[model samples]
Target: MFRTAVGAVGLLAALAAVPPASAESNSDYSVLIISRERLEVATSCEIGVYLNDQLSGRVFQEQSTSFNLPPGPVDVRLRLLPGQMPGCAAGIEDQRSTRLNLQAGQINKYRIAMGHNGLELRRASLGY
Candidate 1:
């Protein structure tokens, strides 16, 4: 019984030497998706998606793309680019810098749709 007590105390001491988990170690991330809600009128151009004024990706009609980003505020922009489709023309540009307020291990969705002024980036509800 005395040997058992000493071994248990030694094990406890070793465990206490280890550092505790930190909040930063969690490294939470957010998932963002840009979905083309519908085809543009008189145009078949692929829209350019920009993150923080840098070109990220392009989305075509009925297509979608996703990004895994750190949880925080992000700047997103969208613009219609010239495409191979005949009669397609560049439309107005859209941009927005919004805070997602995302939580750890959560996903955020956005819909890319055309508004009266130009392209739009709106938050969309998750299906699942």
Candidate 2:
């Protein structure tokens, strides 16, 4: 009994030394943008996605953009990067942030629209 107790205590101590899961944990996500107006050149525009205020990836008018992240809730924001923002990004506001509760093996999609007034003038979410 004494040896068993000592081994159990030692095992518990080692386990407790491990780091806890972070709330900032997240998972990979696939993003798609469709121009509600009309289909533009594949590489004529730039799209950027930000997770928890950090830049995750960018898309240059791709049909879809995918990114991998750690697992939890993430604030996904899409914006126009560099030369893709001739309509805005200078003064006019153009960006959208979507909150997603993510888990491993889960998928999410975000749709943003580009307008003459701003990037992502509108947003639509499909599927959980």
Candidate 3:
């Protein structure tokens, strides 16, 4: 009985020395939030959000989406996606990309706005 108890205690100590497999450290990533809560575009078409030239998410009016990315520079692009609505076809607008620097453990928020040239992203406060 004493040997079994000692073995059990040794196993417990070994288990306690290792960390859980599901443990994730949040400091390794940064949060990116894109919102389209305003009527700046004044269109009903869904906007395609691209990261590193890849489509990551889509946002419509009064909607928002977020992503957790590694700490580095990320290319962000916004364009109107061809949807079920009229005049919402591809190749109708200039496709431009913007570069954003992301830091570790930081939250960045941006809102869609109509720029002088085309659709763009503008920095927004976190209160919303």
Off by over 4 Å in 2: 1-43, 84-89, 94-96, 114-128
Error of 3 at 37 (Å): 0.4
Instruction: Enumerate residue pairs that collide in model 3.
Output: none
Candidate 2 global CA lDDT score: 0.56
- RMSD to native for every prediction? 7.5, 8.1, 3.7
Arranged by TM-score with the best first, the candidates are 3, 1, 2
**By TM-score, is 1 or 2 better?**
1
Tell me model 3's lDDT, rounded to 2 decimals. 0.94
Count steric clashes of candidate 2: 3
8-84 in candidate 2: lDDT tens per residue? 99999999999987653333443333332334433355666677888877665445655554457777666656663
Candidate 1 per-residue C-alpha lDDT over 1-100 given as tens digits, one digit per residue, 9 for 90 to 100: 9999999999999999999986654447778888875554334677788888888999887888999888877888788777787645764444554445
Residue 127 shift from truth in candidate 1, angstroms: 1.1
Candidate 3 lDDT, 1-128, residue by residue in tens: 99999999999999999988885689899999999998989889999999999999999899999999999999999999999999899876776799999999999999999998788999999994
Point out where model 1 deviates above 4 Å.
1-27, 37-42, 87-101
Instruction: Please tell me which predicted candidate would have the highest lDDT against the true structure.
Output: 3
